[model samples]
Target: MNLNQLKISVRLVGAFIVVAMVGAALGLFAIFNMRTLNDADTDLYERETVGLALVKEANVQRYAAVVGLRDAVLATSAESRAAAIKRIEAGRAKSLELMAQARQKADDAESQAAYAKVDEAWKADQNALDEVLKLLAASEPMQDSPVLQHLRDVVAPPSIKVGMMMTELTQSQERRAQQVSDANTALYENSRNVMLALIVVGVVVGVGLGVVISRSVTRPLAVAVDSAERISKGDLMQPLQAQGKDETAVLLRALESMRGQLVEVVGRIRQGSQSVSLASAEIAQGNQ
Candidate 1:
């Protein structure tokens, strides 16, 4: 049926339900986008950022081992040599542990491959260090020695290679994280725009509905009020135009019935007065 045929209560409830539905839909939309953003953030931090940090730590451990080896070669006394050897072993152990952690944290195939290179290079560097240490323990010469030449040619170059590989891995992960951040930022903007558009549409629909329902209710009430005013001024002949099955229609119909009954009662009273007057005249004439 038309809006005017519906009761005011039904019209109001229907409007409210429409607005609630729109609100719920927008809320769910926002929640889904937010969940996506949260997942992206987690992946960026846990998979990429943390992995970068661990690889850097591994490189630092490799540098420490290099320093220990240099000091062991230059040790002047037996006690100093023993202490340097102990420090060198400790640095090697720490380097291995840090590299393992870095490998475990690597996320993608590229990053895993880079870690593998670092691992292979580190193993060769360790083997070279072991050779140098053996010569140091035998009290080999400090300058122009095969151990010094090996350190300069083999161990030093591979140590640099490992550092370079780790640096490249760190840069790659940073770029990936930046890409994720940019994507998430774009998604956020799109979601905000959609939400704003939905809000505007909802407001427009609500206002339009309110105006229609108000006119539907108030127009009939205005007609009923005018009818009642005329009837109060003793003009009860015309019937009320009750258009709908709503409350206002019911009230108007009742008013129309009451006006008809009042008009009939007034006509009966006038007739009775006329009959009494005629009877009085007859009685007076008879008396005369």
Candidate 2:
């Protein structure tokens, strides 16, 4: 209740607030960091996995173009025709190599499924190309013949199937990536709102408790001052009761003891006045 006690109480409250704030900050920081990592994973997967899917589709397209061209080639004695054939073959080999690389680096289920489809499509297309290659090796033109006709018939339906499959795969990858991004954003928002609510609650509770503590400390001082005033009026029959073992109790005890001594002095003065009156009466009778 004294100044020193008030200071101690304030310091204790301050220390508690500092510790609580630090802990809250650390907890919020951890939450924020965890959310960031989650978001990053989603972003990274969207980039790497979807990119692989698109790459696989591109390779499939390249394969289809080469097979279609092979079905169109007619062997001729022209130098330009042979050169074109060789160039198309080289491109087909490069496309296959890229498809293999894409399959190796595929990271997600959707991408892996796309890679599988591309491989199956490539093998089916090769069945037709192999026959066409045989015809080309024979140095014959087959563009208007049954060999190209059979392949065009076989490759058409599958080309349609592969196209639909690739489109579906690409679409599915996009949807999953979008879902991840949306979920990550929602989680971040929820966590931020929760942390903000906690800070607000902590501030309100801390301020309310600090006020209560201040009142508790000052109430003792007010009681001590009132008791001192009562003793000053010579009304010392009852002193204030000491409340606790703290400094407030010590102050009340000292004041109570002083009040008792003052009461005794007042009694002694009253008694001495009575004696002086009686002795003066006796001396007046003797003089008469």
Candidate 3:
């Protein structure tokens, strides 16, 4: 049905419902986009941020094991060597556990692969540390033993490789965090633009609807008012124009009916006055 054909109340109510629906849609849009951002934030914090910390902690534990191995080899007494050996084993175990934890936090395939490489490098370095500790436990001479000498030559490279792997893992986590942040930023910007567009469209539609309804209601009232003024001035010959099925149209038709009754009454008054004048002149001429 045509909007102008609708009653004033229905038009107003429909406009309100349309605006409300638009608002509800925009609200849901914002909520959905915000949920996406929240998920990204959670992943960045729980996986990338915390996982990077775990990898660094594991790296630190491995460094401590290296220090413990060095101390055990240089000790002169068996008791000192045994104590250092215990510390080295404890540190290595903690480092491996932390590495496992870090690997578990890996959220994506690339991060998991990076952690896998880190685990391999760590295992190789740990083996070297174990060999050095075993030699020290057996009372091998720290400076002259072949195993200790060989460890001295090869140990530094594996330790360095482990450090590199830790760096790689850290960089990977950082990159992942950056990607999440960048994606969220883009999403927020897009959502903002869409919301702005919706707001603009809503304003335009509301204004247009208001104008349409206002004109529909007022134009008919204006015509009724002008017709009423003409009838009050005794200009009853003009036809009334009542166009719609609204209340205003009913009022205009009622006014037209009243105008027709007034015309009949005035016509009767004019005919009665003419007859009285004719009767009075006929009586006066007969007296003369």
Instruction: Using TM-score, give the best candidate's number.
Output: 2
Candidate 1 TM-score, true structure as reference:
0.52
Error of 1 at 6 (Å): 8.1
Cα RMSDs of all predictions? 8.9, 8.6, 8.4
Give the TM-score comparing model 3 with the true structure, all chains together: 0.55
Stretches off by above 4 angstroms in model 1 are 1-12, 140-288
Off by over 4 Å in 2: 1-6, 74-147, 225-288
lDDT of 1 by residue, 1-288 (tens): 699998665677578668757776776677677868767786766666766676676666667667667767765457656776886787678768866766776678998888788778877988888898877877753545677667666786677577668667777776787777767767776777677677767766776677677787778888888888998898877788887899988988898889889989989998999999999999999999
Superposed Cα deviation of residue 256, candidate 1 (Å): 6.8
Compose the digit string of candidate 2's lDDT tens values, residues 27-100.
67877797788767775665676566657665666665564454447433345346646655765776676666
Worst 10 residues of 2 by lDDT: 71-80
TM-score of each: 0.52, 0.57, 0.55
Could you give the candidate ranking by TM-score, starting with the highest?
2, 3, 1
Give the lDDT ranking, best first: 3, 1, 2
